[model samples]
Target: MTPPRVLAVAGSDSCAGAGLQADLKTLASLGCYGMTAVTAVTAQNTRGVSRVMPVPPDMVRAQMEAVLEDIGADAVKIGMLGSPENAEAVGEILGTLKGVPVVLDPVMAAQSGDGLNAEETPRALLAHVMPRVTVMTPNIPEAEKLTGLVVASLDGMEAAARRLVAMGCSNVLLKGGHFGGHDCPDLLFEGETGQLTRFAAPRIETRNDHGTGCTLASALAAYLARGLSLCEAARQAKTYTSGALQGAVSQQLGSGHGPLAHFHSGLL
Candidate 1:
């Protein structure tokens, strides 16, 4: 049997922890074949993103067309579109590829606190991409940015999720890491059904969580590619990420935030 195919449209993180690299690793780990259309290149390590150069819009669109026209994708995961143009390019491709599930991670800020997208990119995403997405995964800050609402508590996160649904997203996963609590809570709002589901896991005490958002979003896309429901995909992704974080706690690779153990399941 052939593995599910997932197309990841995102930026490249040279350290391989987040962005396109992390998405590829997560998809592969979750039993999916990964392909990519890189929107930007970043000089980054586990420590931080030092520099970034965005790929031209034409080149970005060409990569997407080449992959989708040939291999085709069961699912698509989008992240870190460096500019409004890049976001629109990705959105145009999404519009063309009908019936494929799209999981979008609105990655505005990096784990190292670097801004990845321009101020106009978020608005462009709302205008062009959000309506077409099957699911959107955003950390609290990103959610707040997208919705212009404060997410200081779990209730606030839920409100933000609903607002995002109003903004035309089919579903929203509001990640609760920025709440700064002992337990990390994530809220999943199903736009079509008006159902809200919550997933909570103990926050792992580790500094090596640089690519966690990308990992989760990619894992969700991988599971969707394998024909799992959105809720089931999110559940499996949370468990997978928790294990990766715990397994990599002791192996520090960079001076700042480090990479999760992408190969943890193999080591077991």
Candidate 2:
């Protein structure tokens, strides 16, 4: 009867809206115990990221090893690896771990267009981390960056998802929130089944969607840690994200892209 343990490997958000803060909040809200291995420290708010300081590769590895060896997470969510070195370190740590589900939110660019990873980081992730990931969640632009395809339509998103599977990711979730559309559709491509599942939700008309991508990925990791299948995890995560978005309309925290109501579940 123990709660599932979910570890988040990402950056620290000073504004508490995105990155590790959002990951931890989402995990908790989805009924999982949360742990963290910070890869960077950022001075940021809803407006934009002002500065970032990457954590040493050795330190990143040390934190991952310590957490994996001790508390032993049931799942790990990776985000915002600030440098190629950090991504490499994370790849190495994931390689050594066994059985735990890993969800990689290929966070290349921030909500405000701030770049998080270096040019080499995406290649490193594909070469070293994709095979280890249980699922990869990428928005349209990130999908384009990862797969080198123009994701102008849903078909393009599916093609990019298939390419990601070819690149060794077992499952891919191509998010269509960035695309210009009325209905936000997300595609789930299963490598083993070769089936494409679609989840469409009405886009919440709110600017407080800053940490939504991070929240969805973390929620999926939490559910997977709790022994849910990938499809089930995605369903639950989508619902949670929609609810968070809907709840954020009345509570705007920052001047720019505000944060979702992570404490809407009352765990915070």
Candidate 3:
């Protein structure tokens, strides 16, 4: 069987916790072929990101064109682009693709509360990339940043999702991880039907959740590439993410927030 191809346009993580590293791990574990176009190189670990160097926009576009023109992709997952130029470069490529699922994780900041994007990057993404996105996964803070609203409760999440849909998003997955509770509920708002679906799971108590957002978005892309519906793909991705968090509960990798156990399913 041919493995579904997924192209990840993101940054490089030195700790192998997030960005393209996590995307590759998640795609591979889900039996998909993973390709990467690095937008930035980060000097980071489990603790924090100290430095970031954005790849040239032309170089980033070239890498993506080389991959898409040759191997091609069944789906695409986009994370931190580092700069507004990189975002427009990626957006140009996205505009050319047809019938491919694109999962956009609006990664404004890292789990450690460190900024990962330029100040103008969000505006660039909204103008160039958001219209082409198939499934947009944004946490509370990202939703707030993108829509300019206080996303502090479930009602806020729904409203934010609605605003995103109104802004031309095909679908919005407003993650509720920031809310304190025993259960983590993620809201999926479908643009076609203007309906909402809630996916709830027991919050796993673990510090090793560094790449969860990356993992979930990449997993969704993988499943979509394999022909799963949006809701089903989200459900599978959430389950995989939860298992990864649970699997890393007993292990200690770094002093700060560690990485998820992507191989928790023992697929390797």
**Which prediction has the highest TM-score against the true structure?**
3
For model 1, residues 1-268, the per-residue Cα lDDT tens digits are: 8889999999999999999998988887877889999999999887788898899999999999999999999999999889999888888889987889999999888898988888899999999988889999999988988899988887898899999999899999888977777888999999999999999999899998989999999988988898989999899888888888887899869888999988788721
Could you give candidate 2's per-residue lDDT for residues 1-268 as a string of tens digits? 7789998999999999899999988988877889999999999999999998999989999999998899899999999888888888899989888898999999987799998777788888888788899999999998898888998988998999999999899999889998767788999999999989999999889989888999999989988998888998898889889889989988869899999997776752
Q: So what's the TM-score on candidate 1? A: 0.98
For each candidate, what is the lDDT? 0.90, 0.90, 0.94
Model 1 regions lying over 4 Å from their true place = none
Query: How many steric overlaps does candidate 1 have?
Result: 0
- Residue 66 miss distance in model 2 (angstroms): 0.8
Which pairs of residues collide in candidate 2?
none
Candidate 2 regions exceeding 4 Å error are none
Tens digits of per-residue lDDT, candidate 3, 15-116, equal: 999999999999999999999999999999999999989999999999999999999999999999999999999999999999999999999888898999
Q: How far out, in Å, is residue 108 in model 2?
A: 0.9
Ranking 1 against 2 by TM-score, winner: 1
In model 2, state the lDDT of residue 199. 95
Candidate order by TM-score, decreasing, is 3, 1, 2
lDDT of 3: 0.94
Which has the higher lDDT value, candidate number 2 or candidate number 3?
A: 3
Deviation of model 1 at 52, angstroms: 0.9
Best by lDDT: 3
